[model samples]
Target chain A: MEYRRSLLEVRDLHVEVEGKEVIRGLDLVLHRGEKLALMGPNGSGKSSLSMALMGHPGYKIKRGAIVLDGNDITGLSPDRRAKVGLFLAMQNPVVVQGLSVTNFLRAILKAKRGEEVPIREFREMLVKAMGLLEMERSFAARYVNDGFSGGEKKKLELLQMTLLNPKVAVVDEIDSGLDVDALKIVAEGINRVASEESAFLLITHYRRILDYIRPDGVAVLMEGRIVASGGPELINQIDRQGYDWLAVKTA
Target chain B: MNVPTPPLELAQEPEELKNIRRKAWNVYTQAPFPDRASTLWRFSSPEAFWIIPENISSMLERGKITYKLEAPNGLLLSDLQQAVSDESVPVGALVGPEFGKFEALNLALWERGAYLRIPERAKIDQPVVLRKHVSGEGLVLDRSLIHVAREASLTIVEVLEGELTGNGNGYLNAVKEVLVEEGAALTLVEIDLTRGTTRAFVTARHSIGSNAELKWVLARFGEGVLKANLGACLSGQGAKSEISGAVFGFGQGKSDIHTFHDHVEKRTFSNIVLRVVLQDRARSAYTGLIRIGTNASYSEAFQENQNLLLSGDVRAESIPELEILTDEVQCKHGVTVGPVEEELLFYLMSRGVPREDAVRLLVAGFLEPVLGHIPGDFREPLDGRVAHSIKPATEVENVL
Candidate 1:
């Protein structure tokens, strides 16, 4: 059997927001080409963990190191982390008034590649990505996330993820507000981007998305720490018995 | 310094204009400096713009003033001084010396001026471009009078560029009066590109006739200190006016802007939108007013001012006021002053954009709406100016 190197490792991570610790002593790892489902109930530090991994200034890492591909990114800025191939699809994307989608996508691509992409080439890439997400061509001209529907915002996130093709992508609640059809499209986007050189950590409160993008491993997070980790059957077990059983076991 | 006597060169003007200049000079010498306690002068000191009498004479003698005007046939475009001597232009029909002290000084000391007239019932598809360039030190005054005849339509773009040389600071006072006749439509764009040891005070007033329309755009990207007063009077029934301004302040720049919209007739409409971006210790103060007269029933008026502070050292103050004397009128005003939202910055930075580029993108987006109101040809150059004004984050530290 071939050896698969771990792409992302979170060791003893402690995160505090506004001086209140939200993520405490959490450890997780994902190997290359692995899809990990991080299941947690509401306010279980799922979003905080994603934010901390992305180096959000507001999410303070009191005591932890986020290693990506053997590089310690604990002290990296958000832009630096992004440049190093760490992508975080925020749950509620902010509205940047007057910034067109086309300009933003081009800017991000240039920032990542460290060079300007020709206008025509960028347009082709944008069209392809938007088409894959089932987005209309007019979406290119619309301001970023301004007056966007929940489904449209999610689609935009997926479009960005597809364009960046990062080594590790933490998709936070990408399927929460999406309908079944939209979920299918999002799942297909993730599946197409999945490769041996990349990994995905899908953070969600429900296992509905796990049905489409079958996870190789499932981890249940409770009270700022992982309580259980198992194979795909653990998802069916949690679905049948609920998280109470896991919470009881952890206690 | 005490008030200086009127210049002796007023004696060289024609009888009619000489009288006007003398009267304006008298007003200029007699009017006391603006009180800092007054609302109009509270944020800015009038002393910064005050010019000594001796410097005014030297400026009149040594200043270099050149202008180019392009207009279609049947339109009258000529030197304002010559037009005044020919008695072909009304000197103070819309605005007079009594309008203010700085206005009086401009009327008395202006050596370079232009007069433009669009003939009645004539429609010019292409815009008339007016370029005025001034280079020198001391006090430079330029005046412009634009009249749109009844049923005529015209668009005028006035570009003001200047460079001040020598060790002493330069003072510039420019006054413009625009008249839109009944049933006429006029679009006026004023671009200010003055830099280097310059103190510019500009005042522009517009009078709209019955059923007339006025579109006014003001773009300010100048260094040093600037005090501008822009006013619009919707005097006739169904008169409409839209005034939009974009100001970018950087590198120790200071700008004080005041706008007034007066709805004087029934069913008249007016709207004003002003956006200011300040960085690197630059400061800006904006006060806008919308007034609806008691007799102007059913009139509508709106005013908005938004300020974006890019650095911690930068300061911005915005005040939008409305006085509606009639119950049937619709009047609204909004004002906002704040630094760039941190969340918005994080959202952009998370996409791999550096902090400086993120700030630039956000500032560009913040100013996009107002810049959208500008013409394409004029907007491109202003974009360059805006980019220049937004310095890197390293230089402007503590940027949120």
Candidate 2:
């Protein structure tokens, strides 16, 4: 194992949704700048882990401790967690009808920076980021995610990641609905945001996105717990032989 | 409540004008208080809007009702009394006691009124502003008539405000009648920012002629109680009307709004979009109707009412009704009443914005469709009012 400083640690996390345990006893760790891909079957609680980490009110943390950098953040609110450098890219972004994309992005930026960013400067940054995501200039003026295509929604998630530059990013199935071209652009965006001080936890059900942005490590989650963890070879094994073998072994 | 006797000065007015007032007074005295079982009065009680005769007389004697009008050249803008005496305007033609009780009272006792006539085939570069202010406690009556001549284009902004005195409760009854002639375009914006303690009753009726267009915007931000009846009749072919409204209610405010789109001719078009945001213990009830008559073939009408509840204590009701008597017409109506989506708030909060700020953003977005229709000069002030209304009660009290 490499000797790298840890950025995020989830210790024996137990999450409940609607009074039913989802993430029973999951433990995970991501070191600085490391890209860890979490692979699981359809009902393996992958999305639950992402939502619980972000302090979703619907996802109750039954028992766990989430440490970011060196602070215990299990009791913090969602906005507090974000302020301490945590970001979660939702699987399905909601449609806000009248909130323009530019206004939403600027508001988040202001919240993160604790000060107002000059309009001209913010416009330049937003335009540059939109261009990188292959979005039109008029995209900034549109209401947030309203009437947006599936691929466009995914691109918007990546665009936020590129701009926020958080220390820990948990992207849940960002590649689920993207086309080949949009997947390439989104992959490029994630790679660009990966830095020495930032760690990535990619949650997915397929190996296609892993091919675009290689993962430093792979972990398999099954029935609310991490059943296996290893180097990139784990992904290859899962690709060849589906999770049935891992499930049998873990059981 | 018994109807107050006609003012002594009423006898001195022109015979025609006095006759209209006398007829309206009779109607007001004869009409019974609206029954709660009626659809129009189901959500609100007429007692909340009842005005004492003594208060009305006192306010009238003290001259507490005032009006200011600003218009361009070649436009006919005059006092309602002058316009009626000169035989230049037909008062009480569109609205009368038959409309409603409050409307009849407004027509009979209105002390502050304006009549605006736009010349034929003329285009006004600037909007005509009518500001009606009631400065003392008691009952205030106001009426206005606007006629946009054929092929003429004009915009009118009506601002209603109140300044209460002492511990007395204030009541305001207002009526407006607008006529858009053939091929004319009229944009009427009514902004009501009455005091929190004032009870307001407002009724407006618009008639659109052949090939005419009417755009109506109503922005309500007052507290206390408000009952508004806004309607438009499409009487000619190729006529179009678009009504957009936004209301923000806070504290213990109660608001009941009704809108009507009556299509009487073929090939007419109408759309109504109303958005409301309620905070604190505020409550709102919205009922809208789209009626396409048998002769209104090939007409199209759509109505949508959306209410956003900001607190658990707040209540909202939305009812959209559609009546289509002819086949070849397209009529649809939708009503939505719900609290802000938790998913939306979570999405915004996950990006570092606080919960309060996130809720504010969602509410502002929910109201943007209608608020965006406000004129540029008034948009910012209304935005401020909305922002202030959404704050926590304790914080709002502190700021106040």
| Candidate closest to the true structure, highest DockQ | 1
Q: For candidate 1, write residues B1-400 as lDDT tens digits.
A: 3556664354446776767777788777778998888767878877777666656776666566688876666566788877776665877666686877778888776766888878799899888888888888766777889889999997898887877655546667788888898999998988877767567788888999999999998888755688888898999999999998888888888999988889899999999888888878889998888889987999998888888887788888887778888888888888888888889888998999998888888888888777776678877778888777677763444433
Give a tens-digit lDDT track for model 2, residues B1-400. 4655773345446776667777777666677888898778889988777665456666655436778877776665688777766665777778965777768778777766888888899898798888888777666777888889999998888887766543445667778898999999998888877776677787888899999999998888856688888899999999999999988888888899989899999999999999888888889998888899999999999999888887778889887788889989988888888877888888999999987788788888988898787778877778778767677432221100
Residue pairs with colliding backbones in model 2 are none
Which residue window of length 10 is worst by lDDT in model 1 chain B?
A: B391-400
TM-score values for chain B across all models: 0.93, 0.92
**Stretches of candidate 1 exceeding 4 Å from the true structure:** B1-14, B70-76, B394-400
Against the true structure, candidate 1 has what lDDT?
Answer: 0.85
Using all chains and alpha carbons, the TM-scores for the candidates as numbered come to 0.94, 0.94
TM-score of chain A of each: 0.98, 0.98
**Candidate 2 residue-wise lDDT, A1-52, digit = tens:** 6689999999999999999999999899999989999999999999999999
